[model samples]
Target: MKHTIAEVKISYHPNRLKGAVKITSSEYAGKVIRENWNQGTLNLYEEFKILLMNNSNEVLGLAPLSRGGMTGTLVDMRILFATVIKSGATSIITVHNHPSGKLKPSQADINIYNKIKDAAKLLDINYLDNLIITEDGKFSFMDEGY
Candidate 1:
């Protein structure tokens, strides 16, 4: 007997992402996005907080927020702030992937970015950029300015 696609089970090993690390360039960011992609037909969208050093451009930690469908990922301001505060980071870069393989930032994406930016300002945590990665090896928003 063979298991059909619908019969298959999938679970995300959140522990596999423990011990957060750094993300330097967009290339490195792309690599991170690729790792979160699911093999199933459904697209995998993940929110990450990239912590940076105050003086230099060194990365401190890469914290994962939520992982699910494109419209399903809910980014909580409290969680985001707690992660950054605990990490003692002064600045951060936000990243998310578009499973449709298009790097364009939708209106909702822009709204989220603005909200995050506003929240970051209150906490004095600089929101550097919000990146969108596609399955076709292309990136948008941060590079082209959405």
Candidate 2:
């Protein structure tokens, strides 16, 4: 008997022209993410997403990683990084919404940011700001000196 392994292939297709909307700062990122978010659920539950970008800070794509209850959501680093790598993004900005309209980063949020930041350093990926989106406004980790 003979056994064969499956072949694995990886690829990335640009849905939009390069540098269509360059990310200049966390505030700009918030605007972009807000436009892509589902406003109907902004204050209904917790959702985590990522903004994938190229070397020039051009938009590559936005991916919703997970959804959870009113309090928190699960972010699997493996899934997050896989999406980042597959998108051919050189940088990533993490975004998550708080239904309670709170802009402060929770301890869990900080922990996640630290893990992603550290892992990004190891993988040569640019880890940008982590934004906490509220119904009224947003919070930036970099702006607050995280």
Error of 1 at 51 (Å): 4.8
- The sequence of per-residue lDDT tens digits that candidate 2 reaches over residues 49-82 is 9999999999888899999999999999999999
Clashing residue pairs, backbone N/CA/C < 3 A, model 1: none
Residue 79 C-alpha lDDT in model 1: 84
Alpha-carbon lDDT, every model: 0.65, 0.93
- Cα-based TM-score, every candidate: 0.66, 0.96
Those runs of model 2 whose alpha carbons end farther than 4 Å from true positions after fitting are: none
What is residue 99's positional error in candidate 2, in angstroms?
0.5
